[model samples]
Target: MSAGDYPQVGQGWAFPPHWVRPVPGPASVVTDHGEERIERSLQVLLRTLTGSRVMRLGFGSGVDRYVFEPRTPDACYRLADDVRRALLLGEPRVIVDSVEAVAAEDADDRVDVVIAYRIDRHRRPNSLVVPFYLAGAR
Candidate 1:
């Protein structure tokens, strides 16, 4: 989704100016750490990653918001499985990497304020399995 369409992901607020947000579903099954908890963890991560200038945040508006992420690659498949379970009111940024990829095209790669809940370790395998795997492509 375009940056202007999503306010939570790329709004002119707490987020970095260059941190473009991704639009995707939330985590599931393997990501047992409630979505709120996941967001909280990511918020902490955003505050901790001292090298990135942009951070992708998955924070939703309210309780109805199904924004979450998997901390490990092994959990991404399961996270995808939960896509049906989570009800997205609007498109939410998928992960911090997406923002990086999109921003890279514009010549901005200083993501020192990322808010990713976790990274999927098996992303390479999924990228190969999935036909249009643009999630981790550089």
Candidate 2:
């Protein structure tokens, strides 16, 4: 089914809310619908650090903790697991298929976290890759 078929997915203000001007109209904040909305939500969930939210102290991923660690196999595995767990706890709109952290080809301090998921009520699977930079890596 097309994205329009999934009205239940709804709409949300665009992440990092940007403004766009329409023809002969004032600028308006961007919005996202259907799958795009879900993807943005996932991005926000993953980027947020646990305990950073004042009212929802437990509402974020723990992957930020790995920023200072070496990107070894063990650290990668742990980061991936943390991402999976965070999604399971935070996003009710998706079923996480897998999460993996792979080193960037030309950057020793960077890891690309690949998240495979299926949106609820959507047939096709989707994946997102979030780049993670290890601050302490040399």
Candidate 3:
């Protein structure tokens, strides 16, 4: 089946559930399919976005390096655009509509990223928001 046909109703092998409380054990196992795949994909995307891309093997290819900046609002906006590009380049099944990043009101070191996109075969637009912190920025 094509990527567009992912999470096929009971067709694809089940993937582990994305979330688990405290710690994951045998009882934490959960079957995932259909739309669940989208959620999982988003989780993967987030991980990739938060990590730095390494040329060598074992290192994740991500946009985290771009996430750090001058801490200006305009910088955040550029970061969002760079994130959108990164996601599109990384995931073929995703058609990105927009990526918006706004500085957190309560924290100067944090920015909230809102991503809007649609899957290849899915009609509805999906959105996810992630807050990123400038770890070493002062």
Candidate 4:
């Protein structure tokens, strides 16, 4: 089945919320669908901190815990585990294949989180690289 055919992974307002204005009409909020929608949802989930949302106190990945910690192997492994767990709980449409946290080659303060996944029953696999910044890491 196509991505659009999956009801569980339907359309939603795009993340990093922005407005789009048509040539002959008013501005409207941008929307996302299918795989793009899921990717954006994952970005949101990773960016949010646990307990930050009043209604959904457990709705985030809590990766902020690593922001000030050293970018060691142990830290990377923990971060990967946190991401995998968060995605499993927050997003039901994806089956995670792997999550890896590795230091960025070009930047000392950046860690690249590589996530490999497949949506529900589809055979095609997808990947996303999210950069985690360690602003105060030593």
Candidate 5:
């Protein structure tokens, strides 16, 4: 049977095969139901944002370029744009609804991003929040 045909290991979000480890590792190799696909997409987004361009053979559009700059209003806007673009290029399964960057009041070099997206399979939206702290940023 195909990956989708297998039963999900649990309710709610399904774990992707790779993310689930075998026995003794707490995680188990489960079926990639609809939720797993979205989970994998989020994982890919995180990896793409943390990685740098040319670091991978075929995939690029990393958001690390904006991490070193000062966390100004304009800089946050640029970071959001960069993240949106990266998501578009890296993960095609989901549609990017909006990317909003907000300055963290607790730190001058920290910013929080709220990502709104819609998976192609459904009309309901999902949101992901990522916090970035640019230590020693100029």
Candidate 6:
């Protein structure tokens, strides 16, 4: 879908019930379509945006691995792998679990652009906010 189809920009996937508080397990929703959602969101944002404003994702170890990988010298095709993995196994937890991992990953350098999961409910001292400020500055 296109950015217009998304309706909201920078907002990533929601944590499936599995990742929810008091039960941080495998959220079937997250386990099912999290990564796909993120990849699509990034694609849509990149297509819709005017400049290279960093992308911050709240993903997990898997999300951090591929999306953050410097595949084409300057390009990080992280979601490509995640999508592949999901497609291969027909899973979503891996994708959704990675959604919260965005705080650790360096996308847009902040917690605003494409942040995923429970950032508002689980803000830590080191939670990424650089982009939030940068976006605000602009």
Better candidate by TM-score, 2 or 4: 4
Better model by TM-score: candidate 1 vs candidate 3: 3
The 10 consecutive residues of candidate 2 with the worst lDDT sum are 1-10
Per-prediction TM-score to the true structure, in the order listed: 0.18, 0.88, 0.63, 0.88, 0.64, 0.19
Candidate 2 local lDDT, residue 127: 95
Q: Give the count of colliding residue pairs in each prediction.
A: 15, 0, 0, 0, 0, 24
Estimate every model's Cα lDDT from 0 to 1. 0.27, 0.87, 0.64, 0.88, 0.67, 0.31
Q: Is 2 or 3 the stronger prediction by TM-score?
A: 2
Q: Compute the lDDT of residue 121 as modeled in candidate 5.
A: 45
Name the runs in model 5 displaced over 4 angstroms: 1-32, 49-60, 135-138
- Candidate 6 off by > 4 Å: 1-61, 71-79, 92-138
Cα lDDT for residue 53, candidate 6? 40
Task: Tell me which of candidates 2 and 3 scores higher on lDDT.
Answer: 2
- Pull out the clashing pairs in model 4: none
Please give the lDDT score at residue 85 for candidate 2. 92
lDDT of 4 by residue, 59-88 (tens): 999999888888788888999999999999
- Cα lDDT tens digits, model 6, 1-138, are 343433323344443334443375553333323234544433343233222344533222233333333333122234334433432343232222232222223444332223232212222211111122112111
lDDT, candidate 5, 1-138, per-residue tens: 334432342234444334566667687545454545665656566556443446665464455676687777888888788778778877776788999989888777888888888765445777888887664344
By summed lDDT, which 10 consecutive residues of candidate 3 come out lowest?
A: 8-17
Q: Candidate 3 clashing pairs?
A: none
Question: RMSD to native for every prediction?
Answer: 18.0, 2.0, 6.1, 2.2, 6.1, 16.0
Q: What's the C-alpha lDDT at position 98 in model 2? A: 91
Q: After superposition, how far is residue 15 of candidate 1 from its true place, in Å?
A: 19
Top candidate on TM-score is 4
Error of 2 at 83 (Å): 0.3
Tell me the tens digit of each residue's lDDT in model 2 across 1-138: 445855667777888889999899899988888888888899899999999999999999988788899878899899899999999999988889999999888887999999999886446888999999985365
